[model samples]
Target: MTQTWLITGASSGLGTALALAALRAGHKVLATARNPTKAAQENPQIEELGGIWISLDVTSPDTAKHVTDAITTAGGTIDVVVNNAGYSLLGSIEDMSENEIETQFSTNVYGPVRILKGILPFMRAQRSGTVVNISSSAGVDGAPSCAMYAGSKFAVEGMSESLSKELQPFGIRVILVEPGYFRTKFFAAFVAPAAGLTEDYVGTPVEAALKAIKAKDGSQEGDPVKAAQRILEVVTSRGLGAGTEGFLRVPLGQDCYNRFQTKIDTLQANLTKMKEIAHSTGFDS
Candidate 1:
């Protein structure tokens, strides 16, 4: 069965790859980007595969309404919604400015909130749909120099988890895709750094982490095409979106899988250590 997919941030990277994959599979794709004209021009293959480009800036306040209206006007229920528009803000928490942090949250967190606000009503009304929130391995574990980016992704992870439960009754599935590092133009898209560097933190882990990311910018091991294919397989599956009826996350790449395991192990260790104390604090009756 062909599904109608609405993909945000479709100009490049995983978004573009997913859009093309859906189109090639005979599914109708609505590819949205901040600059639809530029996206269409750059990725002509999308149009060649009968994909439609729509302008959608995730940070815009009116994005929700625009998205809902666009899909309504297009005359079909959006079977799959992929929230893939976001950027990385690399810096120590102390070094980041208020505006810088808020800007990252606006694009990474609030934007998806608004998009879901716009599209979820239809999904609920129809009682069937799938939402894929593109998160990062940082969403599972925050690393040095990634405080702001990880915070935003963590918010996405939490929201998607809650949303999965909220939409389950309506037969809508919310899946969070956590990818470690893909060979995408993610770095090229944008990397917000701290405006002013404090002397106290120089030559620390923050600096080293930032340097490592810069060095590994284009050498990431994960392939976006394969990632897209994997996501497509899940979205088109017979059962709950991605065969994750009882789950919420899909960690992509070996790095992501390792990080996920590390987090789980850490949590188990903590629980083992504090289980008695935690239970005692909960109730004295």
Candidate 2:
């Protein structure tokens, strides 16, 4: 079956891979970036594969309007929407400025919210659609120097979970793609604190985290093309995701799987350990 896919941040990385994959699969792709001219120039293969590029900056307040307009120009129906435009803010929470934090949330959290607002009405009217949110393993398990990024992804995770339930009656599916490190320009593009590392963070986990991120930039084990293919499979209910339509989240790498499992284990242990205390908190009944 052919479908129309709206993928944000399609200038590079996973977004570009997904656009190409969908186009090759006979789907119409509306790939969006802040500057479609630059994006097209950078990834001519998208156009070569029959994908169309549109201008859309997730940080802009006009995100909803722009997406809606694009959809209208693309034949009035959308099958899938992928919110993939986001950046990481790496630094201790104290080291980050208010502007930096706000910018992070604006792009990572609010961008998807705007997209949902624009797309949900149409999906509800049609009674069918899929919303894929590109989150991170850090969303499930936070680490030092990743507070802002993790917080933003965590917000997306929570929103998607609730949205899945809310849109179930309308036959809309929400999938959170919690990917681990993939070999992309993500690390290279990550925003660090303008002030740089503070003296308090010297020789601390924050410093070590920064070093590890720099070291892992191009060496990340996961492949964006593979990840994009998997996502397409899951969305289309073919290949690896056959007969798995009911799943809500797809963690894409060994590192992500390990982190998710560790978080689950920790939660279970905490619940068991705090059961009595939790019970004690209840009012007399």
Off by over 4 Å in 2: none
Number of backbone clashes in candidate 2:
0
Task: Write down the TM-score of every candidate.
Answer: 0.94, 0.98
| Candidate 2 per-residue lDDT over residues 1-285, each given as its tens digit | 899999999999999999999999999999999889999999999998889898888888888888889899989999999999999999988989999999999999999999888898889999999999999999899998999999999999999899999999999999999999999999999999998888989899989999999999999999999999999999999999898799999999999998889999999999999999988986798
Q: Which ten residues in a row have the lowest lDDT in candidate 1?
A: 237-246
Error of 2 at 80 (Å): 0.3
lDDT of 1 by residue, 1-285 (tens): 888889999999999999998999899999999989989999999999999999999999999999998899878488999999999988678878888889899999999999999899999889999999999999999988888899999999999989998889999988899998899988655564546556776899888887888888799999999899888877776333445566778889999998889999999999999988888876556
Model 1 error, position 15 (Å): 0.5
Clashing pairs in 2: none
Clashing pairs in 1: none
Question: What lDDT does each candidate get?
Answer: 0.88, 0.94
Q: Residue 77 CA error for candidate 1 (Å)?
A: 1.3
